[model samples]
Target chain A: MATTSLTTETGGFEVRRLWTDERSRAIIFQLLVVLGLALFIAFIVSNTIANLQRAGLASGFGFLTEPAFFDINQRLIQYTSESTFGRALIVGLLNTILVSSLGIVAATLLGFSAGVMRLSQNWILSRLVTAYVEMTRNVPVLLQIIFWWSILTELPKVRDSLSLGGAFILNNRGVRMPSPVLEPGFGWVFGAFIVGAIATFLVAKWAKRRQDETGQTFPMLWVGLVLIIGLPVVVHFILGQPLAWDMPERMRFNYRGGFNITPELIALWFALSTYTGAFISENVRAGIMAVSKGQSEAAFALGLRPNQTMRMIIIPQAMRVIIPPLTSQFLNLTKNSSLAIAIGYQDLVSIGGTILNQSGQALEVVAIWMGVYLSLSLLMSGYMNWYNKRIALVER
Target chain B: MTDQAFHRQQAELLPQQPAPATTVGIVGWARTNLFSSWSNSVVTLIAIYILWLVISSFVQWAFIDADVSGTDRFACTSDGACWAWIDQRIQQFLYGFYPAGETWRINIAFVLLFPALAPWMFENVPGARYLRWFSIAYPVIATILLAGGLGLTVVTTDKFGGFMLNLTVGLAGIVLSLPFGIILALGRQSRLPVIRILSIVFIESVRGVPLITLLFVSNIILPIFLPPDVALDSVVRVIVMVTAFASAYMAEVIRGGLQAIPNGQYEAAQAMGLSYWKSMRLIILPQALKISIPGVVNTFIGLFKDTTLVIIIGLFDILGIANAMVSNPDWLGLSSETYVVVALFFFIVCFSMSRYSVHLERKLDTTKR
Candidate 1:
């Protein structure tokens, strides 16, 4: 027994020694890696400093306040060639947001329709949708942008503008339409809208809970729609018509006295929406197909109508598959909005480029560009994550 | 009573008839598929009418009414598409300002690349392993042939910026990015803390921003970053930016493939006493790459299309050249035709690449039970 104990102790010591050697080797390897990284960082840092000093250029954000001497073709806010660089950047950012938001709404609607049509029982409709998706999605988006811009440019000049009745006008300058301007008491109407929205949300939640308990459905959608739309209309009437319209009138050479959307914005928005819609359509189709036929059949077995089955059984499940890819497309559209630069729409990059050239502060301009884009990306991803969690499979 | 019942059953059982051929043939298919319901039939009729209208108009405009042979803008006054503008400026679009006589050099380079690239893509081709190195080497040869660096009339990078230039930049970026992407992907999955951190930072920083920003940095700020006398061409700047952007996205794709690999594969490699790099190069990458072929091809397609964005930086890529060509005094109002032709070109190339990707996905599918 003593001899066996002695042998066990020796074996333990041997195992411990082996472990120590292995641990030391790992430590050394890790240390070497860290050392290498530190050295590389230091090298880059020094090189940057040396290069900056050699170029006799200052690297700081002080240039943001300097006067931007360049003129923007289109501006969302009041901006001029004499505007501060910061203001110019803001104008660019606002334009980017405006185009992207419009594109997203339009693309989503179009995409959902095409995606549904692609799966139709009718062969012709499905084939047509497939052809559209294939043709549009496969081509380069930049090329599409140029294509649309060129098409817009091919329109007749302001003198020989294409007039659609009297309400709308299209020319090389832009498309002009009657636009609404808010009058007095519009604030009250806006307040009513907010109240209606909140009430609709609460009603929807209550309806859902009541359905869960009683196994009875509610006309939540109709109720919500009436509450939301009717309240605003009622408020508007009570406020004695809270908005006025300015209809465009034809002048000697051009349309006057109404809101005009520049051709650059229109081309960018059209190209982005159509191009992204094609991809989104494919994603939507895939999402729908992912829902098994058995699920729909089961809903039918429960005496649900076709539309009812689609709304309740199919869409809920499809959302799970659709949301992730949809978010990516949204991000892509946002990024692609920068293509407005090509057509001189003065998006963030274009404005930034202008500033960079004007101020010779390339590093500062680039850093700002990176920061804004990165923040936008992060915000989008964060929202998507929250949305995904809401609709995720609730495994007990 | 039993006899009556038996007779009733016998009478109920009539002879079975064959299905009508018309109901199962092309006529039936058209009726059911194209004109099943009233609404469907109406839609079909409308579609046919519209299609006929469009086709006839297009054909008449494109061929019947178009002016085919004139030098000035007034020669294209026909109601149809002016193929003459395209014919007039075809060389400008393809070769940009490259010397007309030396166009053969680009042609020869393209011919050489095809044979070199074909073998690399074909698994059944002989010397498959050697083809990998050849793919790497062929680009160098093509670059020299095009750039004319040694004992030849050197074409400046600025002059070389055109459709072929875009293709070369995209292709070169893809080639350079792949190896870098693989390394970064492996490092991200590595046990080492430093490598993991570095890989994550590199990938995320690049991916979180637009490629335009990166291009801006490369174009304007890269010169500042370099030494005082070091002047890199705009083409080089664009190429570097493209490669950097591609690698970041490729790293994410490869990491996805890496995550998909079963841990047992790694364990089995270790059990076989293969070193880390050997295990990765031999066992892991082959499987991961196979699993990620569809994604890689998609990235390739995206990069190929995105090369057009170089136009924003004043490079005369295909789309850029087309845009410029349309603005020529002789073809001022022909922007629509030029754009249509360019869009068609892009559609063909990108569509084929996507179709090839789908085919590869099917061929490489190994998930069947």
Candidate 2:
């Protein structure tokens, strides 16, 4: 083809040939794109520098060391108003991860339940699930957050707080629950718990091997559960009962001496979980539906029980369809946690907003947010990709 | 004797009768769908009880026991919602502080949008082809009417709020994103390495971050990036940011559509002596976009929802205005009523869009036919 093209085009230098040739045209178009992009970037950079200088703001990481001097109520790390901006940002990041992780767990559980319920044999239940999903999903998530926040904050104040027999306390301040206080000898129990987990893995592996070799099935699940829980209990007792509870008591003004979860965290967590769960339910439904009915029939033909069919056949196949979209839902939850700012939940965005206001380093603050969020996105996608590869179907 | 006895008695075959009442109609439906088993009956009863509880309370709070005419928080009772707040501020909710007399301009814009969009939305309607011109001209006309640039009282970006603002931002993001998204998708698929990399980077980086940060860029950093004299309207900045964010997602959706097209189409176009641009324009995109209608609509729904993020940066769209109303001293503690109203509005829009997408999917299901 190359020889024919060269020989045919050798008669004379034809201007029309230049226009007709695809390769030359492609190169020219690409060059134009590159040039245009470069020029645009240059223009923006020049403008940015001029504006920064004119506004009398130095653009760099110098502002990060300055004191944040802003209060954050729902931080995971130790953070004070006197903390540096960098420390405050870290606190914010930790809070983001905490909310996101907790939301992901709750959303997954709720979503899977709802998704399965939507496909249930009962007509009323399925329709109710449908209504729940549609109603929750259609409205804006930010509105849901604000709505929930308002509802929580409207609860009666600390003095008139509602309680569940001195165990769980609820008020406008937040929910106070009895905190588990681990005593000195609890380390032995924790160690035994880890050992039990390893033993469970070994037992499952051995059961599968035995089943493959001799056609004998062992109840690994029951054994594993017993081993894990029993071992922990045995160790705890042997260590002289190393667990105690710090029950929240109603003090003069408020509950004291227990875990005090702020209203902001509760509201944010509930809103994010419920909102993201709606979308995740759709994904779960689609994934389960993607698995053909034949697979379950085949499992039954092989003498598998209903529970066995789901665990060994249907769920494995359904997961292949579920994981990809489920990853995006997880990432979306992480991103949506930024809405915490609307309800005064001092998340990464809220803290960054404060820092931007205080330091006048809008450029750097924005960059930090983008960079952190992008890295988080990349990391999540990478981990999900690895998981996908592990569970991927192997074809010969 | 045996042979005579063997004269076979004719068998009496009775006509078939209808099934029992318990096995037909509503009774049968209930037996099978609701009370097939003990567990099912329990679930059905539980569902009914829950539904009754929810509906009764909702009706009581939203209608029967509600305050519909009172003007302030003091007039509201804790026993029920005060819908009167919404009724009183309905004008502000629909047309945020756009001088009361000039609200007709917004109304005109709102009324004109359907006729413009109808040609494209319902292509089978008669005379749609001729009305395509209206769709083309509507954006400019609506902008002129709303912004009041051509010999009308000018309304600045700050004055744009409420549902009008939501419509403006959402519509602009969706309409502007499509063409740009298509370009980016095509660029990602292009043979040129430079263009492919550029498209990938733009798409990924934009999609990576939450939209609130992008709104921050518009609010705080966008001006710094532009030349000193060219101060962009904040509304325009938001529109631009939303378009950029949405186009990235749109590009991925369109790319999925593009990938579903077999390579034979490309080869066939090449064999016809069609240039790359010509083939993409005439042969490729039309078919790809036809397959992508549902996905595009989904992206539009998501973009519409994301427009609420603009409120985080102090731009008062519907959600923002609702927030403002909640915080207002006169309307304080009426958050539930305001939220319900706002939620209903959004639900209606998003739900209809979802249903329309489903309908379109069925309509375009050529494989079934």
Among the candidates, what TM-score does chain A have in each?
Answer: 0.87, 0.95
Residue B309 deviation, candidate 1, in Å? 1.5
- Spell out the clash pairs found in candidate 1: B61-B80
Where is model 2 more than 4 Å wrong at Cα? A1-18, B1-11, B149-151
Clash counts per candidate, in order, are: 1, 0
lDDT of 1 by residue, B166-283 (tens): 6788788888888888999998998877778889988988888878778777777776666666788888889888988988889888988999999999999999989788999899
What Cα-based lDDT does every candidate model obtain?
0.83, 0.89
Candidate 2 per-residue lDDT over residues B1-369, each given as its tens digit: 565555543354557999999989999999999999998999999999999999999998888888777778887765787877776898888887788889999999999988888888886777898679888998999999998987889987789999999999999999999999999999899889999999999999998999999888888887899887888888899999999999999999999999989999999999998988899999999999999999999999999988888888788888888888889999887888899999999999999999999999999999999
Fraction of native Cα-Cα interface contacts (under 8 Å, chains A and B) also present in model 2: 0.93
Q: Which lDDT tens digits does candidate 2 get at residues A208-273?
A: 999999999998879998889999999888888999889998778777888988888888899989
Strongest candidate by lDDT: 2
Each prediction's DockQ?
0.60, 0.85
Query: How far does residue A233 in candidate 2 sit from its true spot (Å)?
Result: 2.3
User: What are the models' TM-scores?
Assistant: 0.90, 0.96
